[model samples]
Target: MKQTVEPVLQDKFERRFLYLRLSITDVCNFKCNYCLPDGYRPNGTKNSSFLQLDEIQRVVSAFAHCGTNKVRITGGEPSLRKDFTEIIASVAQTQGIEKVATTTNGYRMAEHVAQWRDAGLTHINVSVDSLDANQFNAITGQDRFKQVMSGIDRAFEVGFKQVKVNTVLMKDLNDYSLPQFLDWIKHRPIQLRFIELMQTGEMDDLFARHHVSGVSIRNRLIAQGWLLKSRQANDGPAQVYYHPDYLGEIGLIMPYEKGFCTSCNRLRVSAMGKLHLCLFGEGGLDLRHLLTNDDDQPALIEFIQQQLETKKVSHFLDQGNSGATPHLASIGG
Candidate 1:
C-alpha cells in the first residue's frame, strides 16, 4: 500500500520542503481556559465527522507524494485518538515523510510515550502553561499537573530526543512564572517555547488580559543573561534561541506580536481533512472528498497547488474588527 510520491514547490520557492500539521481528531481531554471559553459547548459533530484511519493514511500518502518531508500530528489532544499509534506508524512509513511528530497536552504521554516512540514518533511538544500545580489546574481546568509532568518525564526517559515544553504566556496569569519556568528548564533536555497569545475562540477577550508579546519576554530574559540567537533551518513558526551555557534551547513564537507571514511555508489539515492554507483563513479546501472519491491523487495535488497559488501573502488581522477569524482550537492551532 505504498502511496505515490510527487515533488512539491513551496510558496517561498524553496524546494524539497513541506511541513504538514495533521490534526487526527478534534476531541481533547483537558479544557484549557485559553483554548476553550466558559459556556462553550463541544461542536458535537466532530466526533462523527473525523476522518477514518484509512482516510488519514491516504491524505498523508498524498502529501508525502507531493514532497512533504515533515508531518506533525496535533489534535484537541492527539493522544486521545484511539488509533493514534497506528496513525503515527502509517505516516512514518510514508515515502517522503522524513519526520513524524506530535503535539499533546501530556496527560496521556506518560502511558503512551514508549508506544508512540516504538511507532516511529521522532519528537513531541507538550503544552504545560504553569509549573505550579494550583496554577496549572487553573489554566488547564484540570488537576492533572502531576500526570502531565509525569508524562513529560516519561517522554524524555523513553528516548524522545526533541521534547519541548510549550508555554503560552498569559499576562497576570502564567507570565509571572516565566523566570521560574526558564530556570526549571535550564537543567532539563526539554526546550522551552514562550508563545504570545493569539486572537482565537473565546481568547479574543482574554487577548488583552494575556497578550504578553515575545519581545518583552525576550528582553526580560536577555537582561537576565539568556542569549537570544537564531537557529538555522528550523521548520515552523517559532524563532528559536539558545542559551550557550544551558542544556536546551528556548523559542519565542510571536505570530501576533511579530508577523512572520512573509516566510510562512506550512499548511494545516484539520482532523476532518480540511486543507487550511492559512492559520487565520476563513475557509479550507475539502480534501476528504478527493481522498474518498476515487482517491484522485492528481486532482488532489492540483487542487492543493491551485489553493496555494491564491494563498494570501499575509493575513490582515487589522482589517476586520476583533471577531473576524474563528477560534484556534477549532482550526487545530
Candidate 2:
C-alpha cells in the first residue's frame, strides 16, 4: 500500500494559513461609506454563487481537512442570511475546524448572540466607525446606533471571551471621535482596534481623502503611558497594547505598516467562491464549479495546494497602487 501524504495550507514562502475567511453571502443591510456604499450590489447570481447549506459544509470541511483550523464567517453582513444560525452551527461542527468566528456591523447580532454563542462561535469583530449617533449614521448610511450598541453589550453579557470593536480611522471624518472611543473602552471589557483603511474599490478615493495611520494612534496611546504587550496567539493580525488602568486593550492593524507582508498566512474566498491569494492581486481560481460538483474533492484539495505556489510576494496596496476595488460586500473584507 502507498503511504498517505498529509496536506497543508502553506504558501511558497513556507508560511502556513490556519485561518480561512468564509464569506457566505453577498447581502448586507447597512451601507457604510468606506465599505459598502449607499447603493452597491455585489455581482453574482444570488441563487447560484451563494453557497447552499450543503456546499458550505463541503467547502469548509475540505479546507478544514487541509489544516485550516479557524474560520471567520463574513459578508456584506453575515447576519443578512435567513440561515445565519444554521450556518454558524454547521461551520462550527466541521471536522478539524477548531474555531469559528464572525465579523459583522452589529445590526442583528445583539438579539441573536445567545444563539451564536451556543452554536460554538468563539470570536466576534464588530465594525463601529464612530460612537456618536450622528457620525455613526453618516458613516454607515443607516440610523442603527442603538441596535449595534445593544448587540455589543449583549455579546459581553453572554460570556464571550473576545469581543473586539473595530474603528476605521479617517482623516477629517471620525478622527475627532477617538477621544470618545478611548473613554468608552476605558471601562468596558471589549477590546478596541484602530484599522487603517485599505484602498479598495470606491474606498480608494475615500482613503486618499480620509485615511489616517494606525501607527499614529498607537503612538498616542503610548504617549499616555500605556504599555505595549507581547503578542498573543490568535488567527487575526493586529498589534495589541494595554493600559494598566483600563478595562479594555487596544489593537492596531495598519495594512501598509512596514514588515507587514513578509509573513502572510491568509487566503480569501469571495462570496462567489473564487480563491484570491492576495487581497489586491488579479485573477482567481473559481471554486464555484468545484464546490457544486461532488466527485473531485481530492483533486480540489490538490488544486488549492498548487495555487498556493502562486501567492504574490506582497499586496499592491503596499506600493501605493490601488487597483479595481472588489465590492467588499461580495469579498467579505
Candidate 3:
C-alpha cells in the first residue's frame, strides 16, 4: 500500500522528509521561562477547532504514504488533552508509521505514562529544565521536580528502553549546571538533550538575556571523549553523542548552527491544521478543510508537495528575524 504513493516528499534542495511533527493542541500547562514564561492563555475561541482524531489519521496517512516513517505528536503540552492516549493510538496504528513519539511536561506522568505505553507509544521526551527543585520551580513556574523525576523512573519500570530529557540551556540559569546533568545521566539510560534558547517573535528581550551557545558545550563534549552518533533518515535535528563509560547519552539541539537546515528532514502541521514549512517561517497554509474527507488524499498530498517548493533554504534567526513564531508553544517547538 505504501508503494502506491505517487512521489516521495522532497523539496527543491533534494532534502527528502521522512519525519512529521504534528501538533495536536497548542495549549500548555507549564510556564517555562524560555517558552511560556507567563503561562498558557487561550487564543480567543480557536481552542475547539484543533484537529480531531479522524483528521489526525488522514494527515498521518498522507504523510506515511509520502514515506514518513516517524511521527511525533507535539503540543504546548500534548498530554493536557483528555484523549491524549487515543491520539497516540490512532497515530501508531496508521499504516507505514513505524515510530510514535511525544514530548510532554511530565505532569502526572507517573499516573499516565503506563497508559500511554499501552496505547502504542514508542518514545517519550520529558522537559526538566533544571535538576534543582528550587531552580526547576523558578524556571518552569512549577514545584513538580520530584514528580518529573518519578515519572522518568516510571517510564523505565514500564519497559521503555530509553527516555530523553530536554533541558533548555539558558545563560546564568541552567548553563552552569551541565556537570550535574551529566552525572544524573551517567548511570541511567537517559539521553540528556541540551537545547539552545531560540528567539521567537514575542520573546526578544528574554532571548537576548538568556540565550546560550551550544557550540561551546559541543566542543567540551568532544574534548571529554564523547563520540558523535550519525543521524538516521527519520531522526530529528539533535546532534547525539555517546560515551563508553557512561550508560546514558548527550544530545545538542542548536538551531543557530551553520548548515543546520541542510539536514532538515521533517515538516510541521499546526494543531489548527495549517502546514508550516519552517518553524520560523512567515506563515502557514490552511490544510484543515482538505483533511475532512477521505477522498481528498490526492489533493492533500498534491497541496503539500506544491507548498514544499516554497520552503526557504534556511531560517532568518541569524538576521534577528523570528517570523511568525510568537512562542514555542504555539507550534509545539
Best TM-score goes to which candidate?
Answer: 3
Clash pairs of candidate 3?
A: none
The local distance difference test score of each candidate is: 0.78, 0.82, 0.92
Q: List runs of model 3 lying over 4 Å from the truth.
A: 1-5
Cα RMSD (Å) per model? 3.3, 1.8, 1.7
Q: Residues 1-333, candidate 3: write the lDDT tens digits.
A: 366536689999999999999999999888898888889888885777999999999999999999999999999899988889999999999999999999999987899999999999999999999999999999999999999999999999999999999999898888999999999999999999999889998799988998989999999999999999998989899999999999999999999999989999999999989999999999889999898889999899999999999989999998899999999999888
Report the C-alpha displacement of residue 283, candidate 1, in angstroms. 1.8
TM-score, candidate 1, is 0.92
Task: Give the candidate number with the greatest lDDT.
Answer: 3
Model 3 root-mean-square deviation = 1.7
Candidate 1 weakest lDDT stretch, 10 residues: 317-326
Model 2 C-alpha lDDT per residue in residues 1-333, reported as the tens digit of each score: 999877887887888887888887778888888877765574646546577888788788888888888889998788888888999999999888888999998988878999999998999999999988998999999999999999998998899966899888898999888888889988887788898888876666787899888888888989997787775333477877888889898888877887677666677787678887876777567887777666767877888999998886777786766554465665677
**Candidate 2, which ten residues in sequence have the lowest lDDT sum?**
39-48
Candidate 1 per-residue lDDT, tens place, 97-180, comes to: 888989898988888899999999998999999999998988888899999999988988988766888999888887888768
Error of 1 at 176 (Å): 1.4
- TM-score of model 3 vs. true structure: 0.98
- Flag regions of model 1 displaced more than 4 Å: 1-6, 12-17, 44-46, 228-234, 293-295, 318-325
